[model samples]
Target: MTDSGEKESAESMLAEIEKKITDAFEIFDHEANKTVDVREIGTIVRSLGCCPSEGELHDMLAEIEEEEPTGYIRFEKFLPMMTHVLMERRYKPSPEDQLLRAFEVLDQDKKGCLSQEEITKYMTEEGEPFTQEEMDEFLSAAVDPDRGVVLYKDYVSLMAIEET
Candidate 1:
């Protein structure tokens, strides 16, 4: 496709995203004022199924405050920033299918569960490598002492429930 065509496609996508963000903004902007409390930004983004960490959300808010420090964001000012954020996929949770696939790789015997040792190794040695404390916290929630294994499918389901 020509450069102009690609540009047009990108613009079209941005418009669609802008529409969605505007709708969400209106969900909180009940006065129809085209502005929302800056603090509500996190809730809005999460409602759209994005999972930016608190630090990341703070960074996003910082960029906004650099432009306008009113403790609120107007739609006109918010659209471009939010469009860039969503387009860039700055922060997104791992999809459930990917989580299940990772567990599948560790299951070896297709048991839909992982031995305590297997999970420990993966958490401590894999990409980004969780700290012992982080792994311990996760284990405390996911493991039942008597089982000696994490039923990852059930664990993931619980995570989904907690999210909702």
Candidate 2:
């Protein structure tokens, strides 16, 4: 296929995945007695840059063995399911694990307390080739250090706070 054709194919797949995810979210929300408007679903799909079809979305949710008890979707279940859809094979760490991982990312120097510059630089490094604006928007302040940089202890503490 031509480069343009390949790009279009990829975009189409992404849209399909996003649609599936949104559909699953809607199904879960409906079961929860909540109404999921197209606007909200569209926002999620657009944010992720992908959409899944109805069948694919349900397949993704099948592992949970849940169906809308009230014949409608619930946000509670939908939220977790949506999270899974987005994360895919990425590790879903426990709270402690998440904190530790965040600490590892911020503590690039192996010394504690990540400086603002360190945090920014480390994030940029992780997402190589990302625009500055992308880095700014996605980088979490949870790892931002005070004074020199965030101490390892401080970074972990910040992560803990966010988890709670």
Candidate 3:
């Protein structure tokens, strides 16, 4: 193959690897949002990409922790690893259960569905508000007034679970 072809092959391989890593982390993040522990870190690491020992992950976390400016672990910093590790834990709630829980958390009303106004108000009151356009985009296709209310299952499945 020509030099350019070789370079393209390498780039393609890298892209594939990146996609795998991204998908793994995305799964992990979803599980972590539900809650997982530090002791289970090694398992999550293995599930995320390659298998690494618990001690290794612990050591890496220790180093990462020490180097942190705030002297504490931050969600943004360890999110990838943490999300991946926790995903391997078997106690994860089913998707349906997670959906129900999310609805319960966000619903704030016994109405059984979140309206655009409710979501917008919730985000605003929480301080990390979403823009009108962003909110619409996030809720689009997921919520349906025609259905009488946004189903909890649809809402959870529709929302992007990645670290934003």
Best by lDDT: 1
For model 2, give the 10-residue run with minimal summed lDDT. Answer: 155-164
Clashing pairs in 1: none
Judged by whole-model lDDT over C-alpha atoms, candidate 3 comes out at 0.55
Which stretches of model 3 miss by more than 4 angstroms?
1-15, 19-99, 145-148, 160-164
Tens digit of lDDT per residue, candidate 2, span 1-164?
A: 56998989977866765566656565535445544543345344333433454345446445333354333333555556665555473222245566677767657677656665766766567644445865565354443433544455654543342221
Residue 142 Cα positional deviation in candidate 2, in Å, after optimal superposition: 3.6
Summing lDDT over every window of 10 consecutive residues in candidate 1, give the lowest-scoring window: 155-164
**Which should have the higher TM-score, number 2 or number 3?**
3
Q: List CA RMSD, all candidates.
A: 7.3, 15.1, 13.3
Instruction: Write down the lDDT of every candidate, Cα atoms only.
Output: 0.79, 0.52, 0.55
Instruction: Give per-model TM-scores.
Output: 0.57, 0.33, 0.38
lDDT of 3 at 99: 57
lDDT of 1 by residue, 48-126 (tens): 6677776788887887663548888777767777888888865667767777787888888998788878999988897
lDDT of 2 at 25: 60
TM-score of candidate 2 to 2 decimals:
0.33
